[model samples]
Target chain A: MKTLSSTWKEMKKYRHSYLMIAPYYLPFLVFTVFSVLMAMGLSFSYFNVLETPRLIGWQNYINLFLQDDIFSIAMKNTFLFVAITGPASFILCFFVAWVINEMRPKVRAAITLVFYAPTLAGVSAFAIWKFVFSGSEYGLVNAFLLKAGLLMEPLTYLKDIRFILPILIVVQLWMSLGHSFLAFIAGLQTVDRKLYEAAAVDGVRNRWQELWYITLPVMRPFLLFGAVMQIAQSFGVSAVSINLLGFPTTKYAGRTIVTHLMDYGIIRYEMGYASAIATILFLMQVIFNKTVQRGLKRIGE
Target chain B: MTNRLNRSVGGTLFLLFFLGFLGIFMVIPLVFTISNAFKPLNEFYLFPPKLFVRNPTLTNFTDLKQILANFWIPFTRYLFNSLWVVVLGTGGHVLFVSLAAYPMAKHDFPGKNLLFSITVLALMFSPEVTKIPNFIIMSKLGLIDTYTSMIIPSLVFPLGLFLMKQYMEDLPDSLIESAKCEGASEYAILFRIIIPLVKPALMTIVLFNFTFVWSQTSGEMGGGYIFSEKLKTLPYVLVQITQGGFGSMQVFAWDGIVAVINFLLISIPIAVFLITQSSIVETMATSGIKD
Candidate 1:
C-alpha cells in the first residue's frame, strides 16, 4: 500500500540499525547461515573435495537410513545416552545446586568451583580419564581392581564394548554438570527468601513441601533452560566419546550419530553423506529441544 | 526436641556425604592430573598408582621444554598464537554480540523477531553441528590453516548475543533516554554507557571465551582449524609430542612431559574461574528471574 518514497523513508529510518548489524551479521551469515545452507546443498550432491559436486538428490538420505546399518546402531546408542544422561544430570545439577545454595557464601562458592571445575578444564581434564580406563596395569581402575583381588589381569575398558558405554556415560555426566549447575545456582540465588517466609506463614510446614510449592514453581524458566541445553548436549556427544573410547569403539558400542558423521565427513571425505548426517542431527536436536520446551511450559500447573 | 535434633544431624550427614562424593568425582581427578606433573618417572609408573608424590620434581617441565626445543617452531610462538587469537577473538565476540544486541534489544526495528529467532536457532545447534559447515565454508573461503579461520568463526558465539540482548533489555529506559537527551549517539551510548553498565555480562562471556578458545586451540580436542606445525597452538604441540610417540615422547608414567602441559592447560582456566566466578554468578543474580 505504500509508495516508493515512503518505503525509502522507512528504509532511511532504520539505516542506523542496518549499519549496526551489518559488520557482525555479515560474518554470521557467511559462517553460520550461509555455511549451513551450503551444507544442506552439499547434502544433495556428491563431492570428494577434489571433484566438482554432482547432484544426487535424496539418495544420501535414503542411504543414511537404509544402507548404513551402523548409523541405525549409532542413532539408537545416541538416544540411550541422551535418555540416561539428560534427565539424570538435570535433576542432579538442580538438587546439588539447591543444596549448595544453602551453604555460607564462602563455602558455596568453593563447592561450585570444585564441581564446575571438570568442564573448565575441558579436554585436558579428560586426559585423566583415558589413564583411569587404560589397558595398562598401572591404570587407576586396573590398579584398584588388581589390589582388590578382583582380577588377575588388566581389562581393556576402552576397547571392550561392555565397559565403554557405561564409562563414557559417567564421564559425560561429570563434564556436563558445569553449565546447568552454574545456571541453577544463579537461578536459586535470584529466588527471594521472602517467598519462603510468606509460604511458611501459609502453612508450608517442611522443606519438601516448600520445594514443590515454592522453589520448583519459581524456577520453572531455569528448569526449562536446563532441560533444553542438557538435551541438546546429550544428543550431541561426540568429542568425549572420541577421546575416551577412540573414534569408533569396539563392536560400535561407543559409536554416536556424531562419530558416524565424522566417519563420513572427516574420515572418508564424503561431504554429501556427511552433510546428510549433519542435517539429521540438526533436525533431531530441533525436534527434541522443542518437545522439551513445550513439555516444561506447564510443569507447576 | 530430640526429634528436631536427630533431623538436624541427619541433614548434616547427608550434606557431608554429598560433599565427599563431589570430592571423589571432581577434586581427586584434578589433583591426580596435577600430581602427574610433579611425580618422578619411577613413581608415575608405579603399579598401584600412588595418590601422592614422594619425590616431587620439575624434570617434567624440563622434559617438556627439552622436546619443544627440538621442534622446528618455537614454543613461545605457539603460546603467542594462542594468546593473540584468544584475546582478539574474545574481544570481537563480546564487541560484535553486544553491538548487534544493543539495536535488537533497544530499538523496535523491523524484522527484530526474525533476527532474534535466527540467533536462538544458532544457539540450539551444538558447536559440533556447526563445525562441519564451518569447516566446509572455511575451505571454500580458502581460510583453512589460517588463524583468521580459527578466530573469526568463534567470534560470532550466539550465547553471547543471547545473553547480551537479555542483559541489555534489563537496562532502564530512563538511562538511555537521558543519554539521548544529552545528544549522545547510539554508538557513544553503547560503548561509553551501556557496555560499562553491563560489566558483569561482559566479564562472564569474556572469561568463558578465554577459557574455551584457550583450550580449543591448546589441543584439548583436535586442535580445530589450524594445520601447519608452526601455526599450531601450545596444546597442539603437546598433542603432536604424545601422539607422535615413545621415541621422542614417553607414554604414561614415563611421560611427565604431557603431565606438565596438561597441568598448565588445566590450571589457567581453573585459577581464572576461582578468581572471577563471583562476578559471573553475580550476573545471574538478576538474570532470567522476573518478579
Candidate 2:
C-alpha cells in the first residue's frame, strides 16, 4: 500500500511530462500497439470485411501451414532473401562506411550521397531497373552482353523463375546502404581517435588487427542497431518483388510474406488468413531480432 | 590519430578501385533516369540503347504536361495534396516526437523503461504487419479518406523518437539543471535550451520525415483510405501516368515522359537530404542503441 502510494505520488509529480508525451503516445497506442494486438487477435478468427469475424480457433494457422502451398513458397523465399541480403548489407554498409571514413570530409559527404542516392530515389527508381532488365535485345544488359558476344539470345530476367530471386537480391543489395549506412558512418566518427593511438602503441601491427580490436568493440551498439535495421528491411522485401516481377511471379518465384499478406488482405479480403501470415512474420522478426541482439551483445566480450 | 597504421599503397589503390567499380553500378540507374528524361523519341528506342541522350529536348516535359492535362483531377491538386501532407506530416512528426523524446531522455518518471522498451520493440518489426488492423481502426474511427488518416500515423515514428532520445541523452544534465535553477519551465527549457542544442537531431528527423512523406504513394500511406480524386498525392498521380492511366500516348514519347516523372519524384527528396546530410551524420554520431 505504501509503495503503491509512492508510485501514485511519482505519477502525480510527472503529470506535466505525461501531458507532453500524450500527443505522440496516444496516436502510437492506437496505430501501433492496439493494432498489433488486434492483428494477433484477428489471426484466430475468420473475417472477409463483409461479415462479422467468427472465431475459428487454430484453423487459420492450420490452413496456412498445412494447406497453403503459396505460403510455403513465400516462407522459403523470404528466408532466402533474409539470409543472403541481411548479412551482405550489414557487412557491406560497415566496410563501405569504414573506407569512406578515411577520406577528406568533403569527399566523404559526396561519396555518402552517391551510395545513399538509390535509397533516396525510392520506388520510382524501379522503373530504371525495369528498363535495364526489359527482357529484350534493346535492354541495357542484353544489349551490352550481345555486343560483347557473350549471349546468343535475350534473357527475360524478371519473368524467368530461375533468375528473378537472384536479380531481386542484387537490386536489394544495391539499395541496402541506407539509414544503417549513415548510422555506421556516424558511429565510426564517434570512436575515440585516442584508442587507435593506444592500440598502435600497444603494438597492434596492422589495420585489420586494429579494426577487430578497437573499432568493432566500440561500434557494438551501432552494429546491433544496424543488424536490427537490416533484418527488418531484408525481411520486408515486398516492394521490389511486387514492382519488378508483378504481384504473383511465375511459379511464385519471388513471393514473400508481405506480398502474401497483401494478396489475401487487400485483394481477396481473407483477413484472418492474412493476419495469421502477419502474425507468423511478426514472430519471426521479433525472434530473429532478439537472437541478433543477443548475439551482438556477445561481440568483443 | 597521426600515429595510426599507414595503409599500404597497393591496398589503398585496390580499395579505391573496388569502390569505383561498385560506384558505377550504384550511379548508372540514376544517371539513366535523368538522361532518359532528356532523350528524344528516336534516341529512346535506339538500337543497343544509349545510356546518355545525344540530343536533349524539352518535348518530354511538355508531353508530360499534355498527358497530365487530360486527368480528371487538376495536376495542381495532386501537388497541393502532396505538399499539404509532407509539410504537416514532417512538421508534426519532428515536433511531437521530440516533445516525447525529451521526457524519455531526461526525466525520471514511472514506466520510463517500459515505454522505451516498447518503442524499441515496435522498431524491430515491419509496420506492414499492422496494416490490416490499422485499416480497421481507421475505418472504425471514421478517419478513412481524410488527410488525418495520412498525417496522424506519421507523428509517432519509432525511429525518430529513438534517434531523438539517443541524441538528447548526450546533452549534459547540467544544462537542464541550470535552466531549472533559473526558474525555467520544462517547456521553456526544451524550446530555449534543448531544441537549440539538438539542432542536428531535429534536422535529421526533419529529413527522415520529409523523405518518408514525400515519397509515399497513396496506397502505401493512405492504405486505400483515400478515395477522392482530388485527395490523391503527387506520387500517386505520377505512378498512374507511368502505368499508362492517362491513356495511350505515343509509346516512345510516353516512356520518356515516364522517366521525366521519375526524375521529378526522386529529385526533391534528394534535395532535402542534401540540405540535411551533414546534420544526419552529426545526429547519428550519438544515435547508438544502448542495451
Identify the candidate with maximal TM-score: 2
Model 1 chain B: lowest-lDDT 10 consecutive positions: B1-10
Candidate 2 per-residue lDDT over residues B1-291, each given as its tens digit: 234374677877788888888889899998998999898888977878987889899898999887778766788988999889887888899889889999999998998889999998888898889889988998888998898877876786788999999999999999999989999999998999999989999999998877767655533422466776678788876776677653233223368788898889888889999999999999988877877
Local distance difference test scores for all models: 0.79, 0.86
lDDT of 1 by residue, B122-213 (tens): 76676666667788778888988998876886687776777778778988989889999999999999999998898988888887777767
Worst 10 residues of 2 chain B by lDDT: B244-253
lDDT string for model 1 (A177-265, tens) is: 85668778998988888888788779887777778889888888778667767887888888788877876788888899988988887
What TM-score does model 2 achieve against the real structure? 0.97
Q: Please compute DockQ, using alpha carbons, for every candidate against the native two-chain complex.
A: 0.50, 0.73
Query: Which residue pairs of candidate 1 clash?
Result: B218-B235
